[model samples]
Target: MLSKSQIKVITRLKQKKYRVQDGLFVAEGLKVIKELLDSNLELHQLYTTVSFDGNLDREQRITEAELKKISFLTTPNKALALFKIPASKTIDSDQFVVALDSVRDPGNLGTIIRLCDWFGVKELICTTGTVDCYNPKVIQATMGSITRVNVSYLDLERYLKETRSPVFGAFMDGDIVYKTDLPTIGTLVLGNEANGISPEIEGLVTNRITIPRFGALQAAESLNVATATAILLSEFKRKG
Candidate 1:
């Protein structure tokens, strides 16, 4: 059984403002919870439908009825957890970095983070306008990759201007990526879903690259940001 206060706190965590206010974010599903548990992130609480190994002092076994009251998912997963929001770390600019310019979709951001983890990209930078990485949907989409990726939100333009490494921005009309010289140590900027890279950020890009279309019609307007990210990261790793 969950108390009303507990219910209120957990349900409120679905919203970003409340999450920021409480200094905590929610992670649902057994896999997601387990991955987070293995990480250094501090667990504030855990509610589960069944007992499991690694149960902590703060763990609570709750009925499904109670879980539904606080769950953000339509079909609640076996477990849900609240973890203290880790403090932002300094950007690791020396290694390959992936930056986003107002990429608004939660799923895209989440997938990109997982992609970064897959390609061994150490740093992911997002503009303040980008969706919060801690958004529940984003957290769900990331699965476990969120634990390994270091995500930071900052002034992208200033960072690009200050960095000595080459800055590459994705665009429709830019030079084909395969032929372009991609350096291992540099910044790759991905743009919003509907709009490609913004003009202001485009001005700072030392290299402009694109994934060319081979179809006879060339009918498709653009690749999904997440899909484009995967392709670009693959190329960057293979050829950079």
Candidate 2:
């Protein structure tokens, strides 16, 4: 049975402030929830229509109608869970860090986090303006990669100013990334969807690189930030 209070709390988690205030974020679908269950994340609660093997104590079996009431998905998945947001770990500045200059799309940020996990980049730094990593949409898009990436929100400019790493900012007209000598350790900065790197962050970039267009007319203005991230990170790994 879904209590009014439980529904209220779960539905409110869709918003960032409520999530922060409650110290919980929601993950839906059997796959995502199961992956989270296997990770170090602490489970707050689990609502489902069927029982999970060992989590029967925490699981609350609810009807499909009850699930639809609290679910954030278009077609509710078989399960939804609330997990305690883990504390942000201190950024290891010496690592090959990926920085975001206000990338606003939840899907993009989520994909980028997955990319970081794939490429072994341990830390992801985002400006406060960037979407909350714990946003339900972002969490959904991460497909459980969120557990591996250490995402921290702070003043990006101040962090850049203090670091001695070679900052690489993705730009449309910057030098082609293919030819550039890439390093294994440094900060790679990606910017907003509509707006590229912000001017303040751009000033700190020691290397400005771009993925060049190979099409006949070169009509496309730019690669999507997440796609660009995939290409650039691949190049960095290849050259490292």
Candidate 3:
């Protein structure tokens, strides 16, 4: 049975401040919950309609009506689990990394995390302004890829400056990505949706690259940040 206090705690997790205070975050859907269960993240509690085969003690079977009360989604999934936010892992400067410069959209950040997972890019560095990876919307968008990626939020410009490998930034009037020689182990910095790369961060970019549009009309203004990330990552992976 879902208690009043339990409902209060779960509902409070929707806010970033509350999540930080509690040192936990919520993940919905059986798939995401199960993925987290298999991950290094510790499960604080599991609320679901059906019993998943495992430690029954940690699982709390609740009605769908009860789930709706705590769910952030309009259509609640079969399960929602609270997982402890593990300590941030140190960024590995030796490998390929993806850095975000104030990319605020939760969906975009989530998709980028998935992209990092897909391309075998283990470390993701984000500016303080970037949307929190643990945001319920971002967690939903990541599917199960969140468990495989190491994401860190910090001062992106300073991090870029400190990196020894070549730093690349995606820009509008930059050299074509396909023609440029991409390093197997380097940092690729992507900017915000509206502003693109900020000037402070721009100064730190060792290489400025862009994906050229082959469309004859060129009607589209720019690719979505996530879509652009997909293309850039594909190009980089293909070369290596």
Candidate 2 yields a Cα-based lDDT of: 0.93
TM-score for all predictions? 0.98, 0.98, 0.98
Model 3, residue 215: distance off in Å is 2.1
Report the C-alpha lDDT of model 2 over 102-181, residue by residue, as the tens digit: 99999999999999999999999999999999998999999899999999999999999999979999998899998888
Q: Candidate 1 residues 67-97, lDDT tens each?
A: 8898999999988899999999999899899
Q: After the best TM-score superposition of candidate 1, give how far the Cα of residue 119 lies from its true spot, in angstroms.
A: 0.3
Across 65-92, the per-residue lDDT of candidate 3 in tens digits comes to 9999999999999999999999998888
**Which ten-residue region of model 2 has the weakest summed lDDT?**
49-58
Model 3 scores a C-alpha lDDT of 0.92
lDDT: worst 10-residue window of model 3 = 212-221
Pairs that collide in candidate 1 are none
